[model samples]
Target: MKLRSLFAVAALALLVQVSMVAAAPVVRENGAFSCTFYNDGETESWTGTPGNVDWSDAQIASVMRAMDTIAGLFSNEASRKVNVSFVYVNQTIGTAASAVPLMSTESSPPYAPKTKTVWTADDLGGRGVASGSAASVNNLEDVWKYGHYLPSDYADVVVTISSALHLNNSLYYGASASGIQGFQFDMETVILHEMAHPLGFYAPGRSDSKTALEVLTSVKSYAGSIDPKFFDGTTTVAYLQKHGMGILDYPYAAYETNDMASLGVEMSKDGSHISKWVGYKDILMGDMALSGVVRRNYSDLELAMFKDMGWSLANDPFVAVPEPSSVILSLFGLSGLLLRRRRTA
Candidate 1:
């Protein structure tokens, strides 16, 4: 009788352990943002140093904190809760990771009232919609009904990170946390940039060569109803002439000459990517990710661009006073003119 009771207890404990592992979603929350992470069914592997660390859980938690920091940057409460899922892919796409819009309102003819709910999915085609939740549905509709500019949904924004990549773990910085030390490539920076795409910073057309003119032109034409002030104070022609084509044009071809292309020049697809033209070096949304450094914060222009996309924002502490170095760099690209490189989609 005693032996049977012990055996029964052990079996029950084993079953419970299995159940916990199966149902457990590695989740982290900070304020308005919550991120859930999963494996892409690939045998998870991390190369180089830190051989014994659980990279997936640690990286996912780090990513969640990064998302939370981004959320705090904007003062407005997210009308629809933003849930993001990170799936670890074992293969390298190109640079590190890529983001795809799982669902979005059509660009042409626009939606009624000019506000539409957009949804993004994971690499596995999982749209992060909440199951059996009326509040989720109601919140999604509220964003559209009120003509809110930002894409609002209670569903998850699916992001995929490469498990095969050597992500630097030494340097870490995020909205709510910082100074996490590791020697690998900064995973936080890559995750932050990719996640921003589903939030409404996207360019139309293929990934290889979406141009700044294409993005500005599209916004100017289709999004006018949503944001009338998009081009109110800005003149592309003057901007091009003053700043030079390299500032706004990707794959910029002054080739052998100093004269820049016309204002509406075409280059790479927008992908909601900022041109290496304006604030090239420090901003999070630029075209390249350097190893070892983490760009955990967004630039003032990036925040302004979010506002232009129709999302409400909080007062930005970073831009209240202009940094003199940035001002000088903008006035003159003191560094020699360099063409923008393509990043992971």
Candidate 2:
């Protein structure tokens, strides 16, 4: 009898394992997260770049993983998919007083050269802690900035990264976790954040090659109605990120709208970066930072919240139905009746 029961239990466990693996839906190489790798080593060698423009295989995988994480969350939470493509470049990079590369190849729609601007962060008015809490907006001139110059053929959104940033063997950065003592940035997090910028996650945008319009839109997105999801655990952010799930199809929201909640992100002093501001209290992982380095926050309420967002939050879909109030009431009433009978007896 014991042997039979053990065998049955083993079979059940195997079945459960298979079900769980099958349910999560593996990410394929060709789908929404279809990433393109680039190397910024041609000009510098900080992490793993051998030359000024080459990337090692390990560096490529790290960024892809970070994209996968955010993508996975959106996929699971919003029940949709986001197609992502990446670009690696070694444009003039440095701190605040940075070098801006003016290349003819960078001239195009949405890509602008923001070489002549200096930005400072301040409050919306005379205010409190909330003012410093978000990133200040930097004006990006598509006519003058490089975002428009980026090759847009076969690209919906493009993500660029640093070669040193992806190599964690020494300074180790990227998404895996704490890096070797050398690097401070996370490659995966950066990809996730930057990718969000173009997909309408951070702001609404237009494909206009017109510099004035995109700059205006980017500034607006930083402080605009941060998707309540970024602000809190509202279902809206997930819904926006994942619009198509299983056979169900959801319409994509406009790429530029405050409809998504946020902590108010703006550009850095150089206008080269944008995200939830740093050097302040760390925003939760999932919370959208003004910089490209964080993820959507998570808490115990995560499962319940995703369910409300319309994603299947059940551990076992067939068995995950909520408890019926009627059943509970019946059980309580029956217990009370039995207690009364005993007292009378």
Candidate 3:
């Protein structure tokens, strides 16, 4: 009788462990407890609810294939790797569906204590959503929140598709399969560039402000005839620290052309670190190229950064994402990572 009782207890414990491992929070809007997505199309985000994937197996397979394509980008030629925890959410939700959750109380996060933040412009304030041009939806306000959701911990790369991403004069559509190929790299390149920012790829002296317009102006200026400098450290960093966390924004460790030239990457003829690797034509001083995945599969830099954050890129599962900015500040072997660009040839 004693042996039988022990076996029963062991079985119960195993079952509990399995439930905890596979447990995705049940989303319940009317009840009380729930999970949340920062925006629509966030991987399978649920509120006091669990996701329902009873879709045609074909759709599920396509989504999984898309995920695989994204995962392959981590192994980039530049050796910048990508390590992340996968959070799933729906591409859209009706008014009656439910809101996403966010834990805002922990002085330091990753501890929600059950509280969640819904995906809305009122809170996050258009951090990732695009503005200006015909794609502008700000006038609608609520319509703007329909963009893809980024998780609290964030991912090395965020690939979202939705009705909101129409190529109607929006800055995000330049590289989309629907628009002009940015006259340079494909849409994949831009996606890779954005991913590199959160992963700490640009030079350490990057700006963290919403200077997309400003940078565009500079790029235009340079295109016309002058030497345009769009970003500097203080400008963006100061703003981000004020709004979000400092390390959470850009310039934490940008790996600009100068930063990499010393590593024998061949920057440019002029000593200006204003570009890095644009697409294929100009490897300017400030331009960002393949991280590490501008797409080479994955990058060592990415693996190292993730490892610094206490997670192994190769050994870890896809669901173990750490805080986005947690390990970005870690100083890797300070080799030519900080060298000054010199006019050579």
Write down the TM-score of every candidate. 0.54, 0.38, 0.24
What is the alpha-carbon RMSD of candidate 2 to the true structure? 20.8
In the range 1-345, model 3's lDDT, one tens digit per residue, is: 999999999999999998655343222121111212222222442122223332233323333433344344332222222222223333442110111112222233442322112222322222233334221111011111222222333222233322222222222222224444342223343333333333322221222222122211222121223333333222232332333432112222443232321211122222123243222233212343322222413333233222221222334333335565654544332323554323231
The sequence of per-residue lDDT tens digits that candidate 2 reaches over residues 218-303 is: 33332334431122222322332343211012122443643443322333332323333332233332333233333333332233
**Candidate 1 — which residues are off by over 4 angstroms?**
1-23, 39-57, 105-154, 166-183, 204-215, 218-267, 276-279, 316-345
Q: Cα lDDT for residue 258, model 3? A: 27
Q: What C-alpha lDDT does candidate 3 achieve relative to the native structure?
A: 0.29
lDDT of 2 at 331: 94
The top-ranked prediction according to TM-score is 1
Deviation (Å) of 334 in candidate 1: 46
Quote the lDDT for 26 in model 2: 16
Which has the better lDDT: candidate 1, or candidate 2?
A: 1
The number of the candidate with the highest lDDT is 1
Candidate 1 to truth, TM: 0.54
lDDT of 1 by residue, 1-345 (tens): 999999999999999998655334456777665565554332211111112123455566667667766767655545555555556554454557766443333332222222213322210012132222111112222332233335533233556666556443333433333453444456677777886765545543333322122223323222122211122112333433554532234333333233233343221244356543442356677666665566777765555445433345666432345689888886666333432222322
